[model samples]
Target: MSRIRIGAGRVTAEIDEQGAELCSLRYGTEGQPGATELLWQAERAWPWHAPLLFPVIGRMNGDRLRHDGTYYAMPKHGFARDRRFTVARHDATTAVLALRDDAASRRLFPFPFRLTVGYAVEGSRLTVSYSVHNPGPGTLPASLGVHPGFRWPLPGATDKRGHTVLFERPEPAPVRRVEDVLLLPERHPTPVRGRTLRLDGALFTDGAVILEALNSSSLIYSAPGSPRMTLSWHGFQQLALWSPPEADLLCLEPWYGLPSPIGSDGEYAASPGQFHLAAGRSRTFGFGVEVSPAR
Candidate 1:
C-alpha cells in the first residue's frame, strides 16, 4: 500500500488494491484540513478525477485508431495515476510512484513506456515531475499534463452559476482555435463571458481560452476580489477550464495536448501539442500550482 501525507495543513491518503479492478485511494483515518493535497483528494473523496482524456478532457473513444496507416489506442488518459503502481520512494513531503506497461497496457496502448509520477512539496507549492521512457522503435506519440481540482466555495466564487476562472494576462493570445474536438487551437482568443465562456457543464459554447502565449503563465479562480489560490502552471503550454453543472469543485488543467475534435486526425502527425519520442530516448513534462497567502 502507498500512503501520501500532505505537508501544508496536514492531510493523508492511502492508495491500495480493492475489490474493483480499478485501484482505490482513501484519505486519512482522521479528518483533514483545507482540502486534501491534489492527489489525496482523488484518493479519498473524488476517486474518479476525470479519465480517458490526455492532459485535457473528453477521451477520443477508441482504444486504437488507424492514423496514416499507424495503429495506437491511448487508454483514455495516458496510463499514469490510475494503473496499479509501486511506491518507488517516499518521505514526509515527497513521494514517487511508478507503473509499467504490461500485457494489459500493451494490448490497448501498443507502446512500450514507463511512467513515473512524483510529488515534491515546497512550502505552499508542489512541483510535479513526469519522466517517460520510450523503449520501442518506429516513434511513439503521447501526451502529458496536470489535472488538479481545487475545492470550491473558494471563499467567494461568484453569485453567478459559472466560476470566474481568470488568467493573468490582459489580452488573449493570437494562436488558438475554438473547434469541436478540443484538439489543435486556431489563432484569435475570445472574450471571457457568454455561451463561449459559460461555466456550466460540458456545454462548451464559449470555447476554452487557449493561452498559447500570454504575458504570464499563471491563472487564478476566485469570487472577484477575495482571492483563493493562484495556480502557476510552469512548463505547461495550455490551460483548460471545465466544471460540472452544479459541482462544488473546479478543475484548472495544464495540458501538453488536447484531443483532436471529432472526425479529425487522431494521429498526432502535424498536430499541435503532439509529442513524439524516439526509441531509448526519455521525455519529460511538468506543471505546478502555487497556493498563495490569503489577503
Candidate 2:
C-alpha cells in the first residue's frame, strides 16, 4: 500500500513492493488505480485478467510455447506485470521494486535471477524503467514489457474528442489476432505519422491491436473532451492497445516480442523473442512512457 507521489501538480503511482506498479495518466496528481480492483473483480468481471499470469509473455502460440529445449505454458500475457514486489528504493519522485527467484517462482520459472523496476517523475513526465539481472550459473531467455492503462477522458474529461492516439507515420500495419494476443504488424519497416485515433469500446471486439508504421514517437491518451491530461509512448517498438470489455481504462503495452500465432512455434526453445545471456552475463530490453497533460 505504498504510494510514490510526484510534484504538487501531476503524475504519481501506487506500487506494491514486487515492482508491480500502476501509473496514473490523469490530472490533479493522484496515482493509478487498477491492479487491486482488477484482482478483486477478476472472478466476476475479468476472469481472464489473472494477476499471476506467467511466461512466455504476450500471447504465446496456442497457449503453449517452445523455450530452451522444452515446451511450457504461457498465459494470455506474461507475468511480472501483475506480481507484487519488495521495495528496493524510494524517495519523493521515484521508486524501485525488485524480485529475485524464490521458491514460489521456481515452481514456474526455475531460474536464479533478479528483476528490478524503477519509476521516476519530473515536471509533467513520469518514466518507468525495467531492468533484469542474472545471478545463477547459466543464462535465461525472457521477454518483458509494461502493461499500463491510463483512464481515458484524456485532457481532463472535458472534451469528448479531447484525447487522441497519434501515430507518427501512416503506413498501414497488419492488424491480426493470435489465439488470445493481438499483433500490430507494419506495412513495411517504417511507421506512418499524423494519424490520430479516438478510442472507443467497440474497437477491441476481436481483442488487441499491434500498431505498426508509426512516425509519431508518442501515443497520447487524453481526457474525453478536455486537455487536462495525456500519456504518451516514445521509445516502444510495438504498441498494443487493450482493455477488458467492461473496464473504463485503456492498456497501452510497449512490448519487445509477439508470440507466434496459436498452434504455431511448437518448440519455444528460448524466450519467445528474448535473447540469451550466459552465467555472469546480462541482457536488458525495456521501453518508457512520458505522462503529461494535453495541450
Candidate 3:
C-alpha cells in the first residue's frame, strides 16, 4: 500500500492508499525537540492505526446481509477498510481518495455506489471528510463511521488513568453495549458523571460503550500535563469509545449506524440507524481533530 504525506504548520499526517486509512499523525516536525505522535502505532495488540467504516458501521446479523431475498456474506465493518482506493487528488495539505463499486464490491454490497475520503491539515488540526454517492437505480441503504485510536497515556501525561473525556454537553442518557459483536437490546447507565467520563480499562470488558443518544457534537480528550485534543463532528448520529484491555491505545469512534440487533433477521433495508440515499444523490459527513498545547 502506498502512503501520502500531507502537512501544514505544526501538524502532519500520513494516509495509506489501501482504505485511505490514516497511518500516522504527528504534532511536530521530525528531529525537532518535543515532537509527539498523536496516533497509535499499530502494535501487536491492535493491527490498525485508523480504519474507515462504510456501507455498514459494525457487525451484521450472522455476518450476512439479506437483500431482495438473497443473502450476501458481509464482513464486520464492511469491506472498505480492505479495498484499495484511487488517489483522486493530492497536494501539500489535502488529498482525496475514491472507490467505486466494482464486480468484487457488488458481490458483497450489491449497490452501484461511489465512496470518497478526503484529508486536510491546517495548523494543529486535521479534518477527515466522507462522501457517499448512489449511482444505481435503487435507493442505497448504508452507514458510515471512523475509528481513530490515539495514544492512551497521550503526550506528557504521567498516568493513563488520569485521562478524561469531557463532552460539550451533559450526557446523562443511557448507553448501549455489544455482545458477540451484536448490539444488546438493554441500555445501561452511562458512566459519564455530568459532562466528564474518567478513563478506565474495566469499562470496556464487554465491548465499546455506544452512545446512541449523543447530545454533543464535540468533546475534549485530555489528561493532566498532557496536550489536549478536541474532536468535533457533523452528520454523525452516534459515538463510541473503545480500547482493548491492557492496550496502550484508546479509540474514539463517530458512527452513523449501529450493529445489527441480537435476534435480527439480517435484513439490510430494515436495519436500525441506516440512512437511505436516493438514486444519483450523495451525502457527506466529516469530523475534525485539533490539538492544543498542554498547560
**For each candidate, what TM-score against the reference?**
0.71, 0.74, 0.98
- The model with the greatest TM-score is 3
Give RMSD to native, each candidate: 5.6, 5.1, 1.1
* Model 2 lowest lDDT segment of ten: 34-43
The number of the candidate with the highest lDDT is 3
Error of 1 at 199 (Å): 6.7
> What lDDT tens digits, residue by residue, belong to model 1 across residues 155-241?
444443545566666544453544443545345545553222334554444444455554557766555433445567555567665
Cα lDDT of model 3 by residue, 3-105, tens digit:
9999978788999999999999888764476678999998998999999998887889889999999999899999999999999999999999999999999
Instruction: Please report the TM-score between candidate 1 and the true structure.
Output: 0.71
Model 3 residue runs over 4 Å out of place are: 30-33
Rank ordering of all candidates by TM-score, starting from the highest = 3, 2, 1
- For model 1, the stretches where C-alpha displacement exceeds 4 angstroms are 1-3, 8-47, 50-57, 61-63, 67-75, 155-166, 174-189, 192-215, 224-227, 265-271
Candidate 1: RMSD to truth: 5.6
Candidate 2 runs further than 4 Å off? 1-9, 23-26, 29-55, 61-73, 158-162, 182-194, 212-216, 228-235, 270-272, 285-295
